[model samples]
Target chain A: MLNVTEMLEEIKNSPYREIEICAPHTGRVNFAAIQQGSKVEGPHGLWKEKPGTLLCTLDRERNPKPIAAVEKGELCLLHSELEGCFVEAGTRLAVIRHLLTRDEVQAAILKKALHLFTAPERAKYYFVPEIDKKVRTSGSQSVTVKDGMELFIMSRMKREVPLVYTGPAGLIYAVYFTHTSNVDAEQPLIGVCPPDQLAAIQEVIMRVQTEWTEQG
Target chain B: MGKSNKESNVAPAGGLIDVSSHKVLVANRGEIAMRIMRACVKLGVAFTAIFTKEDTASGHVRLAKELGGEKNLYRVSSYHDANELMAVADDAECTAVHPGYGFFAEDFRFARRVSKRDRKLIFIGPSWKIIRELGDKINTKRLARSLNVPTVPGSDRPIYDEMEAERIARTVFDFQVQQGIKRPLVLVKASAGGGGMGIEEVYDIDNFRSVYRRIRNYAMRQFKDEGVLIEQRITDFNHLEVQIVSDRSGKNPVHFGTRNCSIQSTGLQKRLEVAPGFSPDEINYSFDARKVLDDIVHYSLTMARKVGYDNVGTWEWIVTHDGSPFLMEVNTRIQVENGVSARIASVKGEGGVDLLAEQIRIGLGEPLGYNQQDIAFNGVGIEYRLIAEDPDNRFTPWAGLIERFGWQEKPWLTMHTHVPTDVPYEIPTEFDPNLALAIVWGENIEQAKDRGRLFLDSLELKGCKKTGGELKSNVAFLRQKTAGILQF
Candidate 1:
């Protein structure tokens, strides 16, 4: 069993504790050129109303990752505005919406409110071990990398992320984890992990599964 | 009255029809009803479209109004309500009634009721006596035996208990031993129904009681009869059937063509039907299939002639693993998949009319099979009967007005039927949950199956949650298992 009073006390104490998640694929603006201070609405440029910056990451597998500035904000595009921006898997990103005020979120209510809380401001940060110091300007550098690799990278930086996308064509597994009791009480939980990603997602699942199995 | 209202008021009523005129009331729904209604129109006779609340919106009713005018199209409570149907026919002054292969199509009581109410309501099919007689497995088996058609060893009557099923299985084993059969399996089959009703294949003797009891309960609920017939299970068998047409003048039996319904789940209801025969490879695998069909047809015709079979019917024959044929059953009226026969018939220069249309045409003394020998496959006609059900709930029938019916056209196929707007259909709990059939006519079995697969993908029927999509997947699985190529 969980002590509602202790869980509530912990939630109160940590109400404003900040958690940062870096979304690596959110800020690469492709095909962009800077005219000192001139305003231009090219494919790679940020919207005229709001100016933003981009960060890039390079992977060893010949695929470059771009993190756009828009990834730091809430998903605010109309349904039809976002057309074809794609994010590959394993790109580190964090969602940091302010879920609840210090007075609102209690452990007793948290059990029934997974979807009710607001998400945090999601910010993306990219990492490339080799290109930690590399920076690119329009039209110069990386011409030999590919025909228009810089341009391609710039154009994608500001594009809105598609909420839904197709996964790579291969096997997929759906894992479910059920929490059987409150977190403070160290109660049982039920966890499920797909066979392929058993090792990766298994730790979280086993704890939950053990709780649920024991509770039953 | 305005022209439209005038037209609506002027229901197609021929001049004062005599009491004995050969006016026909079609007792069915959908394309079959429309098809039979056409026959009445062609004969220059009055046609009455007896419909349920659901069938009011159907194409058949509209066609009746077109042919016989507005007055000819009437409504009924239910097709199976024999007394109400008879009263409607009498009120319409119809001389005959055609049961179009569903609802009351195979029902003996409906036919008998109509006949009793109006002696001249000439039920345009096999007699009620024949429907009842051939309906019973025991009697049909005996008839098959008399015609020299081989039958699985079993009793001629419905079994009452587990002991009877075991006893029959033992007898079948002994009979198989005498015939040199090894490890023979027995099937407990219902005596008085078709379409794989209450047929359970039992391998172990211990499983016999449960299988028997299950089928017994199912048969009792379905046919109002719990009697069962036991037969030797013919494994690795190819199902073949002959379409025989006969009438009052004499038994005019002819083999339209043979179709192999072998692509099905063993010991269960038939799922897929491919007509005009399967590939040569299938035939080669079962060497005696063709000869077996010939024998079965010969014997079926003989039995029909002896028993005074009228109009059109089908004789079901199954070929054993050792290339021998046995009489499985007989259907006394139109079949759900008779579109295959019509498709082949049309390519040979005959009119593209289905079995119900053929029955009407034949009954009216129309010439049939003018070029029977020349008739060949136009292509393969594939059909999937849609059953309304929740997919997650093991596909139980969900009854209601279909909310959506959708289609996407392709160049290779043609859809022969259209939904009528007047019929308000609900899934009746009393009957099989199948709502409608989706048919695809293609150039070959492969092409047809391919079109069937695509057609299922594009089809959308609103109102009821349907299993056509699921069945489409099942059909693909079956085709793959049977090594049938469905190139799309």
Candidate 2:
């Protein structure tokens, strides 16, 4: 059994340039590493040297890169907070930059998931605009609509912005845009529109990015 | 853009090669085709029946042969071109053609082609020019505006995008507010289509985009044109229409009073109709709206005379709570549920159907003896559209043979859309959603409704349960909705 905070602290100090987390069959969240440049060693020494890594952008054509290799099986953690959660035991939680020392690489991974169990949450869902097309795509395709295409709220409210989704291709993008509200603590609040109108009806999703600001 | 390449071709005028000898051909199908065929029989003219492939076994086609000589029957393709239908008339060695409603009824191009290329076939019903004029929604709206006939408020042009949709919605919302109309709703509708097709309602802004997209797809699919218009959604309204007939001879036009078709499906799909909308005072029902009918006839006649809509057509209107009548769209051909009007037109003589005889006479330039002053009613008439679908399943359309058919027939329960047995029948998907309807007339509205319920309950269709329960359920729902039973 591993301590959640200590593991997160070790991973934060590690040297991964990009990080992604997923609760399989549920959802995936990703973030780019902020480390400018770092190098790390591998178990196989001089004969097989790994390249140093930086927070460089991947080509537009590629999907996000993965860092951890979580086995496709259930996991159990002793911590009360991670009771129902699954994290691979002894998993190499971080992939370091070729330039960083093993110690630094481990530290970066720890910092990233410092509040792993208590972190605020957000959700995104993809829905098929029409039944036939979605079936054809098989939920693994991507459609490219030009940016600023006008997303609408379930109510008549609309804003011109493209909805980007790394989910099912034929489905329109809908997300339970979760955020911390002043009114509630423990539970994250989300904004969502009506279901029937979630499909290719409107282009951009009118998300409340800054509720504290008054535009009018 | 290129002047449409469409022109109304006029027939070569003369006493139809030989009025007594020339055969009349009806290049159509269904009850309307039968209606026209009956008119031909009265003229003492040898008749020809041209049927589509699907209608070869139709009761109408079969009945046509039983009434007319066997030599008059001819078969054509169901999906064949309209010109092919006209050619069927020519092949049958016929002198005239009557395009029954549905296929080529409002097809001005086909009408012109029949009158021009064929030269001999007299095009019955509206002149091709009138069909061209009123067949278009935008042009008709313009004409209505010019005639001071009130129509639903909305943009006069096709709404192409969301901004325009929102703009129109905002304007209409504002107008509704200014007019003191509470909780006003709006509708996005396709201009070219009719019969409740390609119309969607938007209750609030959030749903507008979704509704607009659906409506756009439907409009494009149905009319093959994505020209959609937005209008204020009218609620708690009564659908009323006056049947008007005009002829080229043009002495005084006839108004067959008003029929109330208030009971309707919420959307632009098939609607169930009830006639002689319930009124406590028969003489003074919808008085202001009745005056509006007079104005509507005047306007419709002006437009009809200009375009030349002879034969049967309806000047449709709707009455709101303020006791004001607003002009709805005009139906160029006889309405499908117009069996009520058919019965009203029918005069029981010692020998034959009186109205049927009179309609034929009017076609050939003769007087219809019954005047406005002579018009009187025996009872109330109610007509219900029997859609071939399962009601519990959102009315998904059903197509198959009607194996068994029986209805509660009372003295006043005159069932039209006569699917005569003694022959096989195949109901097709090409036309209306409604396969058939049972029209019942009574001493009053309640009696008519009771007879309607009886006819609906008694209707036994075996091939598929034609939702007699759903129809009865819907009628009950409507009665409650209109507060017909609950009204003080």
Candidate 3:
């Protein structure tokens, strides 16, 4: 039921997302020396121990704090006018255009092909305690979720209520929300893969890994 | 000039200390910072405030901009950075620094740097020497024992020798047994280790040796110190603290009575505090609550006088269900529950006494102007820590946008908060999730509890997360606990 070639073709046509960097608080902004079209790398290395490229520094109360890029991208525009000037919080400092990598493209295609389990209500979502421990120690892909299984703890108004899964039994292929984050009602919380679709999912991954190329 | 100044205001024995020319840098954030700034204004002294990026929309920043006017508020990167605070102080030309409750409040190094730097700034607290001396737990115990003030019966020094350690343990057990304690517990822990590491509790005296040996060996391997401490584990005691205020000349010190802060979260964080420490007339306590309160106050003042404790501090104590009281430790900084004590306090014939104003007045090189006879206590005051947290889930902090937050204003209720009600505010995750401190007062304990319940019922706190889920608060929990306040 999934068309891998068509999904890859659709992503190849337009494979970029624009990200705007905003000031986290009121401060004097100073743009790190960067030119338009300059390449920037996001955080990398195992455990993300290495920081990404420095975009600028926000100086407040004689203390300078570094702001780094969150995604690998090309510098599109810099708000140089804000340099050396005091700016309020939420001020847009820069715009970056990032090219979608093979991993991201694979993720985009998989989201469409997999059976997505959605949140029933707009609340903070977390895996139930026992499943949470398992998911944390192992990966989400190793955990199988089934219909009527208590899979989540929906937290709202300081109270926690258990949420039961209602989809086909399958491995949790993707997790859309972290324990600290909130999810909207009817939004996908996890993408599940049925037992028979394992071959198709593996084929999609194999094709993307072998055929997809990174754009310069 | 001395004669005229003495006639104008009650000057100390020396003369009136003119601190009108001084400016203070409030080195903190949120409620305490706002309190300090307001105190500075009341004392006719200029003050500067600092806030990090996330706290830009905090009520303190708005208050600073309104009252302090232009160039008085600085945006800081972090509240924990001393260099940033000092640099701001210098840039703002502030004459002194006020380390409110946290951050640099208890750090002697920061206090020392504030005084010892080339361009010195007065640290609005005890001198660095006093802070250093009392900051050490062992030193504080030794000081208390030296003055014959009652401390928890334990070995004050590290027990390096097995024989001496066993002797101290035997004495602790025998003392507990004499006190009619059932199944006495002994705590053995590595002296150099902290945060519950290298610690064990022995319920049976026969198990003490094995636990001690294990902890000592672990301490030697992990902390590189074979030293261990042996003490009787105390539990089921009500927590109490005495508020001590003095001038730079620690000679004439006074107390603002005591407060009961035993109702705490599972993590030992205080949630509710009641003034006067105990309610003997209203609630029939197992002990002589009135005498216990007086004893703690007396012992606390004694230690304050002995150590020349100059500035605002708290002497923490714990009273067993029986009448025995034990000095726990000293917080050499102004505490969060200071307002509850102030609420029940009055000066001379005037009912409204501002202890923060008093602290700033004396902290900025001024005299106390009054003594014990001028101070008096009236009424029962209860302070509820209104926070966005789950009471059923170990008080886990809830973070989200507070769309609406307010309560009915009453004559007896004093609310202190940094959350802005006029605008939708996002709770900052870096700090405590405390929304406000609502202190309600009454003529007696029953009325105070009644008003506390009424206040909680009147409170309107509504919010939501990024997910459309509603905000969670301890308002109901607070309402339910209102009846049991200050009870044994």
iRMSD values, candidates in order: 32.4, 27.4, 8.1
Mark the 10 consecutive residues where model 1 chain B has the least summed lDDT. B1-10
lDDT of each: 0.52, 0.51, 0.83
Better model by DockQ: candidate 2 vs candidate 3? 3
Report the lDDT of model 2 for residue B409: 59
Winning candidate number (DockQ): 3
Query: Whose TM-score is greatest here?
Result: 3
Clashes of each: 54, 39, 0
RMSD of each: 23.7, 21.0, 6.8
lDDT of 1 by residue, B1-488 (tens): 10112222232332122222468888877767766776555445567876654445556667777888876765654566565556556656777888878667767776676677525577777777788777666788888788677776677777777776688877886777787767767878776556665577777777888888777766764567888888887676667777776644444555566666665533345555566654443335435545555677678778887787766888887776666777877888877667666655552454454566556655543334333454444566655555554433433334345545557866544444435433444333334445455556666565676677777666665563232232212423433433353210
What lDDT is reached at residue A192 by model 1? 16
Give the Cα-based TM-score of candidate 1 against the true structure: 0.58
Residue A103, model 2, lDDT: 37
Which sequence of candidate numbers ranks them by DockQ, best first?
3, 2, 1
Candidate 3 lDDT over B222-278, as tens digits, reads 557899988888888899999999988999889999999988876566888999899
